[model samples]
Target chain A: MKLKKNLALSETGFVFDPSNGNSFATNPIGLSIVKMLKEGKDIELIKKNILNEYLTDANTLEKDIYDFINMLKKLQLNENETSND
Target chain B: MKRKKITVAVTGLNAIDSPGPGVPVIRALKDSTYFDVRIIGLAYESMEPGIYMHDLVSKTYQIPLPSAGKASLLTRLKYIHAQEKIDVIIPNFDAELFNFITLADKLKKEFNIHTFMPSQAQFDERHKANLPEFGKKHGIKIPFSKMVFNVGEIPALKKEFSYPLVVKGKFYDASVAYTPEQAATYFNKIAAKWGLPIIIQEFVIGEELNVTAIGDGMGNTIGAVPMRKQYITDKGKAWSGISIDDEHLMKMTEQLFTSTKWKGGLELEIIKNAKGDYYLIEINPRFPAWVYLAVGCGQNHPEALVKMALGEKVKPYTKYDIGKMFIRYSFDMIVELKEFEKIATMGEL
Candidate 1:
């Protein structure tokens, strides 16, 4: 998806993706998702990696992960589910 | 129409006494003429508040956080607090929202609360593969993508999708391998944990757009705004954003919302490629914090949500300033640089 380049973030996990001009106050987990997508990781991969890196459950993590992915995609930081993944 | 006190359930890890989104939204609804407002939170940690709750709270209660293994009455006591009259549960996170949706029917019947949530099937529409499913049905242009289950499938995926292809997991999976080797390395380390496949999406170089809206479960739109990201910080929150009012984008979003019959809050993401054609990307089924930025222009959504949930009629949002901006001027500038370097070094920054 088309992402706005005007991003402003803080150490405390505050983020503003300038492409859409939508600002967000994200948790550390949410921050990780943004970083991964920005690094070209697919939404699925980002969710997978985050769960592995953090000490959390699989199911709950998945839902939150899915929610965040939806957030990123809807924010236009990433496109919709076009992956054959 | 059921005439009952409107309830908004806000789930938290524990009863940490602090003024967060829940307090403000609850307080706003408390003043509404439509329904009585009560605050609810999930207890994950100890039961103590760092700060005292406001006097406006009519009643405050803590329901133990529900877990997959433990589904006890205490876990669901918050719903019962309304005593079959609780109307809404606004999950602040994925797990909570999933919980609310899973119990939507039961809550409606037992509590007489009209919960507007995406169905279990509808939840898939918001997954990583969500856009593809939506677009495939309606011909919404999206980038090429590849989803893989096993690491051995990497080479096969590459041949079909290409190098810049993004490796993806299910909805929230983020483990990646830019190359077949990286993908395999990650898979080898994490495969046992996930039962689902991962994906690799074609890296499309383009601009990003963010849209936020509140709907009444019908085609008519309530509070809404289209934003162009202006300033972004290192932590990934929109440090600053400017609201954009575009008809073409709004029209496209309207059609999708109507088709989905989406209720509650909604956000649509679209991007324009070099061809200048906008491709459909994703939809968020909740209130985006960034939408709060629109309040200055007369779009106060958190307030609108309170009004709507209270059974108050809201006028459609049709006009707003386009250049309004929000930004985090100073972040860990070094961290920002690192991120910029990561993207730029790869020619993506």
Candidate 2:
């Protein structure tokens, strides 16, 4: 799963797809995950960082992260939606 | 003489395919010779192009949608008023007018925010459902209209309305139906979006004429400009329009003001038939999306509205150059996500 290179993600969680002119606003953690994904961070690494920083257990964090990624895909923010790795 | 500086807050900044009157209203305010204005844009969405148009809107704060109800709206406005000290507020959206009207008196007493608008009674009378009665009461000819709650009611509409009638929502959206089946389908569509009581009206076939006018609280008109839409968008909004000289249209506008004792900005949507009679189709209590045409024609309705809100004596505008035209165009600006972020997260930018 990869973040779209065409998507402009701001520090404060505003996402704009210049290609389609669609804009979206996400929460703080969502912003962090998008930034990490843009940097080509692996799911395990992103999961580890979020679990350590946020007040959540491993299972819940995993679930939440996956849910958010699914949402990104649904919103067409993912570059390669079917990428398994 | 130095221009007196005052802060003004305006809503309805969405300048899109279905545009709002905010940007052009701000432009009119900016052109004011008397007041050097600081514009505070009240936006409902972060991406409303007006929020990012820094040259026109000095700053923007996202307010809760009217569907969220009035208290939340007031709280947000209170926060904005504390920061901006807004002297006047011009609300442009039809959906949000009720909330603003409800807050009008309190805004004046508590924060001294002045708004010039029609009374609650006048506002209610002009609603799409109520327009037939409103036209009747004011001695204006209106196309026969009936309110329907269910698809079953659509079949019965053939008695009063002919084929190719208009199906309208309570607040927005309208579709022309040439058959009962089409009317039922459009009923479901409009009712799904805007909710119950879809309005069915006799579709008057004629040239559409519009007049943007402002009325003093008393039975006096402060400004009136008549125009014919040259081009219309798919959403039924005027894409290009021209000011025209029409005595009957102007007289009808005067009669409406006299009868309603309307206050603030109003746009009369009229359809003139082959028999040369005008029918009142709709009355938008706020300025129409094509309000800038009024400015282009030299009426400057929004500016005059501000003057009235501030309690200045404004004489009725008697003359406007006929045949002035306005053609709207869209521009794509490279807005940084940071600006969008501030408005989304912090609710202000």
Index of the highest-DockQ prediction = 1
* Tens-digit lDDT track of model 2 for B208-322: 8888999998999899988888788888888887776677788889999999999999889898875567899888889988888887877889989998999999988989877
Measured against the true two-chain complex, the DockQ scores of the candidates, in the order shown, are 0.08, 0.01
For model 1, the superposed segments whose C-alpha errors exceed 4 Å read A1-85, B1-7, B12-38, B43-75, B78-87, B169-177, B184-195, B306-313, B327-349
Q: Candidate 2's error at B2, in angstroms?
A: 1.4
For model 2 chain B, the run of ten residues with the poorest summed lDDT = B241-250
RMSD of 1: 19.2
Each model's number of backbone clashes? 75, 0
Candidate 1 lDDT tens digits, B18-78: 2123443444445545455555433333222311233543333444444442355334553
lDDT (Cα, tens digit) per residue for candidate 1, span A39-80 = 667756776797789998888887887776677776555443
Candidate 2 residue A29 C-alpha distance from true site, Å: 75
Q: Ignoring the other chain, what TM-score does chain B have in each prediction? A: 0.72, 0.98
Best by TM-score: 2
